[model samples]
Target chain A: MIASLALLAIGLALVVVGPRLAGARWTRQAPWLAILTWQALTVAAVAAVVLAGVTLLIPITAVADDLGAILHACAVSIATAYAAPEFLPGRLLGTVLAGVVPVWLLVCAARVLIGGWRARRALHRSLDLVAEPGADSGGLVVLEAAAPAAFCVPGRTSHIVVSRGALNRLSRRELDGVLAHEAAHLNGRHNLAVALSEILLRAFPRVPLFAVAAVQTRELIELLADDAALEAVDRVSLASAIVSLAEMRAPAAALAMAQGGAALRVTRLLAPEPPMTAWRHRLGAVAALAIVAAPLFLAGYPALSAALSDLCNI
Target chain B: MRPFGELEAAIMKELWSRGEPATVRDVLASLSTSRTLAYTTVMTVMDNLHRKGQLDREMSGRAWLYRPVRSRAEHAAALLQNVLDEAGDRQEVLMHFVADLDSASVAQLRSAVEAARRQGDSAPGDAG
Candidate 1:
């Protein structure tokens, strides 16, 4: 149990800090996006290779099972209490997760509800910008503000909002660029990216590397949006608009691809790789998968096999 | 508009008639002598086209050369797609346009789709 806890701790620590120390070098490359993707691949590859390699060498299958069963048993008791909340659940966390599952879960459930309410309230409040009615493939929701920008608030139903100042300033051509950029954000599920980054960062705050990785991921999301807009419109127009809007683009607020600054995006737009012809895109996807698998292989078979077995429990 | 009114369409048209990445000077030179154009005005027009996402540009010393990123066929297809997407449930309008497709063109489209399906089928993981 001590060893397992140590391993988990170390893993979490690496997850948090490793990105900051090393991720910066990659984001500086010519096509920051290509490098961003490469870093993501690197993270997955490292994780997989480490897990598979450790699993191959160490056989902790039995102990892991015992630990998992204990955890599961605890979970079941907690779930039961929640299912039947009449059980006088005294301070849940202080008592329930104190090896008394039911009370803990009630506490957790309460916490989650409160957190969700707060989050919803914050989201409703943040959307201070008015929505402009746009007629496009998916109706566009524009926020007319002086903040030269674009961003998609991600969820079950995504909202693409842009600033009013952006609309007023941009020519129709430039407006197309901004609209397409925002569309790319929606299509890419960048809100998830932001959420994932935040979760990863919060989970492993010590690892400066994780923060670096998150920042890189954020920038890459913008680049990806720029790439999509290029296809919908002309690269030059996108690039020009990005340059023009750099002054007006907002910083990342929640889910949107905060309008990018001029220098990097413009460079990429002016000289994109012919939209990565289909074959090349396929190659990239394949490479990403391979990298994703490497760390899983390293995590060691015993834990993996145990995980597979546990899947039956689900 | 001038080109449409008088350009003798034969082996070439649009950007091709002038050749790829033609400059304002190049296009003006080709234009029949009617109006004198200053460099900045022509530059601005090309710039506008570029900004409109109609033209792609490349750096050439102090100036930039521009090209049409999409071919004429692609532009037409995109316009058609855009119209279809915009026309909310305009079945009659859509059917009228579909009827306008020449028999040979329709045949070509059918063959193209068949070929695409065949190719897709042949590709790994394409089958359910």
Candidate 2:
């Protein structure tokens, strides 16, 4: 029980502090690794908390001394609260924490998804009316407005939108850079990642990890797309396009070509860094593995042993 | 098959080609030659276009006559311009548009363009 509580404490602490410790600069330096780290933290934190709750029930049923008796005890308590009067409080708390929290999280996730779906439907309906098939061969839709904007709507048939303003304002090279950036987002399926992060953040708002991860993931995906765009566009052109288009806004549901942290993106473009070394890559992998595995082992091992012993004793 | 934006394009084409305000019936007759469509569908499409500020409608007797609000070229430009006038958190929606650029940064970009031009290198070309 003490060990379970300690593991749970560690998990909670990680949930609160992990993102802060990572810091924005760390993530900006190695976004892919940062993504892995954030994902592991979120998963491990949830697993740890749930496992901790379940583990607490282990000692209460330890008298049973085996797995079968532990289940029987749990079922009996749930059926009639008085069945295990001595351990009723722990049983109730464990059941509530382990069962109710997930359901609540699931509900929150559903709400975010439904909202996103509705927003997408509304946007597509309006976009269909306002935009025209672009003259460019890439199957983009050109909006008549003079706002120098470009973005991609993600779906079965994703459409890239480029305003006439952007086409007129940007030189050929600059326009290509902008289009490539938007295309990178579409091809990479960054919308799904952004959506998932959004769902998780809304579902678990209190978990500092989710909030930070959501923001960082959003930022990282843009950087990733920018990197992909660099293959076809020179640094100066991409940077210039990003700056010029910085004033244009994409709809909330869509991933705009040059959204958020424009200055940081521009700076990174001008002074590009070499990819991380193999040793650093290995270190990142190992760190991610450890972060994900720690909570599960700490919380699960004790619960399993206690449940087995309780069943045997019963 | 008419997909997505094509309905609006077709309706706009009819209006633009007629070069005059026409009733829904007139637009429908013109569009029907390409592909048969119901009057209500055409009416609804036109009504939506009007609501979107793409079409202007005026009542003629008991029926409403509609025309393109602007020339095809002007309309396209207006739609793109509207993208800049969106109401929301400016930072949140900031995408390709530059909200802020100091004189120095703009100058730097100009020089970069000059260098690129001198080198005869265009943006390595668009998406493959």
Candidate with best lDDT: 2
Classified by CAPRI criteria, candidate 2 counts as: incorrect
- Error (Å) of candidate 1 at residue A272 is 2.8
CAPRI quality of model 1: incorrect
lDDT of 2 at A232: 91
Candidate 2, residues A1-314, lDDT tens digits: the string is 56557667977888878778456465666777777777777777777777666665544333344556556665444333212224677678777667876887788778776765654554455566657888787757888775456766666566678777677777788888877887887787776666666767887777678888777776777787888898998777887687566433333224433234566677777666777777887798799889888877776554455445534245
Q: Whole-model Cα lDDT per candidate?
A: 0.46, 0.67
The alpha-carbon deviation from the true structure for residue B46 of candidate 1, after best TM-score superposition, in angstroms, is: 57
Off by over 4 Å in 2: A21-26, A56-92, A247-260, A303-314, B1-19, B30-63, B68-128
Cα-based TM-score, every candidate: 0.43, 0.73
Query: Which residue runs of candidate 1 sit more than 4 Å off their true CA positions?
Result: A1-132, A135-137, A142-148, A248-261, A273-292, A302-314, B1-128
Model 1 chain A: which ten-residue window has the lowest total lDDT? A53-62
